[model samples]
Target: MRKQTFFLLSLGFLSFTSCIQEEAPNAECDIVTCRVINLENYSIFYSRHDAVKEVASTDSVVTFPVRNGADVSAIALELDITPGATVTPASGSVQDFSQDGVLYKVVSEDRHWSRTYRVRFVPMMVLPTEYKFEYYELDPNSQKYYNWYGMNEEETRIDFWATGNSGFRLSRSSALPDEYPTVPVEDGVSGSAVKLETRSTGAFGNMVNMRIAAGNLFIGTFDTQNALKDAMKATCFGLPFSQKPLRFSGDYKFVPGKDFQDRSGTVISGRVDQPDLYAVFYRNTDDEGNDVMLHGDDVLTNPNIVALARLESPLTTTEWQHFDIEFDYRGTVDAGRLRNFGYNLAVVFTSSIEGASFCGAVGSTLWVDEVKVTCE
Candidate 1:
């Protein structure tokens, strides 16, 4: 398996600490920061302007989204390193990457160890038509982390992809992909698809009243801030989407769990579990001119919402089935705003629709593959 890494923005500036190295007692040598920039314009672009995320962690791969018509032949990058590390393709060094990617090497303070990183730039104008999740070669580190991301043909990680497994991993202890709430499955409609499931967290989750974690996947950021105030709204939804998607088509298989429980962990007698699948296209700005985004609490009721699409009812399937859901337009979309990315869109999936509130069964499972965002 190949080792691939990715980083998406979370909108908040993070404060990072660095180690002091005198070139003698130092053994750690690695790249700390990486991003693309326009030397002439003095602009730093770490996150894509077309996406709604920011770098929230240090383990993320540094990616840059370059707009068309910009200087592409010769590119400049911004990077940082450990105190004892010296990087080649040195900081602010100019290189032509219009044809191929460049590898930047960093030598540790001890001068005995080194690591190399692939510096890449991707176009932000053309959003892929759909996702198949087939290009990924999940690393061992990725297995420990329940999140999965998509990349373009150029191998640039798509910021529009995310899942609920991150929230579940906070309590679950399993490290392998099979133990994760969201993972890749060998059996699918075609190639490998993502397997989503609700699982028990042994004693840790139950002690806190969170008994089961319903599997989920969505196009948004997961904010731990909302975990206490409103766990349902914990996963912030929507992204800067340029297209007015009309229909959503995909293939899925579902098997609901046997016992149903709410956030309180109380049994709901005779209540059959239901899966949730929906999409929302809403304005990215509020009436006050400030930026806006939706969460599970407001994805359906946000005043700026132009349209919404949801599965008609609970889908209980024994085998993979092709399904399509049409977006129900509520209000007109702003033509001017659409071009400027004033509107945001999100598509969400969960084994338990009520999973947002930690309400679902433990054994519920959902397998999704080949998701397409239809325009015509």
Candidate 2:
């Protein structure tokens, strides 16, 4: 089976870390980063900084958001890949991206592993205001898990949504898409809704002291490799935003699993699972001019946060419920910075409030749909 890698290119800046060089050929085939050389010459981008992309370790697609009227034909990309690997349609080579998605292949130096990447370019960012959970599909390569995305008014697929499903794959390769923590269900307020369930990670998870995988969906990216070293940091949160958000509204149904457990999988006598839904707006850069992102640990408490809107209490009901929360401003927003994409917005949904700590009941479930973010 071929290894999989995912890449997301946006109008914001990101600096991807490179892997250390190994002495000998290894079985790793990955695309660490992607960029266009001296992108200033390309007037098609909203910003020259938009040309570079930070790659992640799961999924099989690469997407770039370009300004309207940008010519993708003969567009060239320079990829920074694993030391001993080689990519086809070679790096720094021009490829026609004017039509259907193009496929790029990468073979490891050891020739033991490979990955095929699907690349596509979409026109300008359409600030996502509503999410109905109507667009989703199975992972292209494995067909083992589902990937959810939002569609814009132009009918273009938006890649802003990210999930922990990829991280869950690390423990359950044989698990079916439905058996995975996050899935789509037919019984929705409308057509289809997302269902997040806390699931047992079985032996593999227990071995690593991570017994349960929480179902999560958020506006950001996931790094599987980083999760192994530091789970909290693995869930990079927020995306560049150009507006001041006012409120977050959504519909949902929830059921807390019977037995609450800790990271060691030991059930706590009286503890109960709780669902979490919140939206955060914050500065995307630090005082030192370095790009910044909140993780599972500090997303809510980060000093950079400008405003936050979260449910005050847990909601548990079999029937659908509605909630609308207003953003509580903690700081001021600079109009100049807002126009320059200096801030970010993150909206997160999880079946278990403490899922990031691997503490949740395996059967806790939350169904959600009709999400809307109101802005000024």
Candidate 3:
């Protein structure tokens, strides 16, 4: 009886071991069935139909495995055309797939349309980066202007005029009728002929340092007020003198000790009745109310003329002297006391006043050239 019982017990133990091994195989099969491959960032995965598998019915749970760095952000599921072949998520998390990866069934359904799940990643950050003045040149020909190293052009000319009396003369080679004469220099370069001169008392002084170029005569004068006026009005060689008023002159005789009190030289010399004269050129103003002449007492406190170099010499027909008048129109004032007036550098001219004469004449001349204003 004891032997029989032992034999039965051994048999029972063997049976239990066999059952355990069978259960282990079933567990391994379950794991293998749930295994899934991950795919993302691949464009072909979206249209790849034969890449994935469909398992279980619509109510069954599905699982998938993913590789490292695989973007499962977007998932898609394939649908069979049969009535109940459509997929719907069941118990656990739905099978997440990639748009670029294989499609898998989560839960089965019958619809023919495929469904996809998508997630968008946050976009990367980026900074916006000084503005850069375009240079331009005003052309004398065609009265045009060009900008950006001559890449762009326009038809606008800056009106520039000669100062005093040196008239403008157009060169034969000038493309514009009113253009200034330009002379060719070394290395095929060219320069404009703009001369400045101060004449002696009597003789009409030729523009000092006049240069001829392209069959054009560039001349100027300083000294005789008439010469200056003539130059301002001249249209020599088909070049039109800028009708713009640019030259302004004034005359001031000393009031003996009163006006001459702080002056550097003798205010009144013997046998000399010194008369102060100034000329102004402008596009002739028809407004009678506008004063085109000025007087000594009127300009005594004038700030524009205060700093200009004063010309002091005996006027004669045979000799001419150059007086450089560097004007500062920046000090001109519209209205105010003598000490508080401000000046406009752009508007410069002489004011009209009674009893002021130029070389004891109604009209006189002053020569002007190389008129330049800088905004540095």
Write down the TM-score of every candidate. 0.70, 0.84, 0.19
Query: Which lDDT value does model 3 have at 283?
Result: 17
Write one digit per residue (lDDT tens) for candidate 3, span 210-239. 211111111111112222343222221111
In order of listing, the candidates' clash counts read 4, 0, 55
lDDT of model number 3? 0.25
Q: Which candidate number would show the highest lDDT if scored against the true structure? A: 2
- Best model per TM-score: 2
lDDT of 2 by residue, 19-55 (tens): 4456677788888787876344867665555677777
Q: For model 1, where is the 10-residue window of minimal lDDT?
A: 4-13
* Candidate 2 Cα errors over 4 Å, as ranges: 1-24, 40-49, 64-66, 69-76, 88-105, 110-124
lDDT agreement with native, every candidate? 0.71, 0.86, 0.25
Q: What is the C-alpha lDDT profile of model 1 across 1-376, one tens digit per residue?
A: 1222222222122223344444464566666666555555523232234222243332334445555544556776667677868888887777876664678787887888877776555554345658686754443454565456677777776656666666566676564657767777778778888888888766777777777777777887776545655776778797777778899888888898998988778889999888887778898877776768788777788888888888777568887888888899989987777765577778888888777767889889988888888974
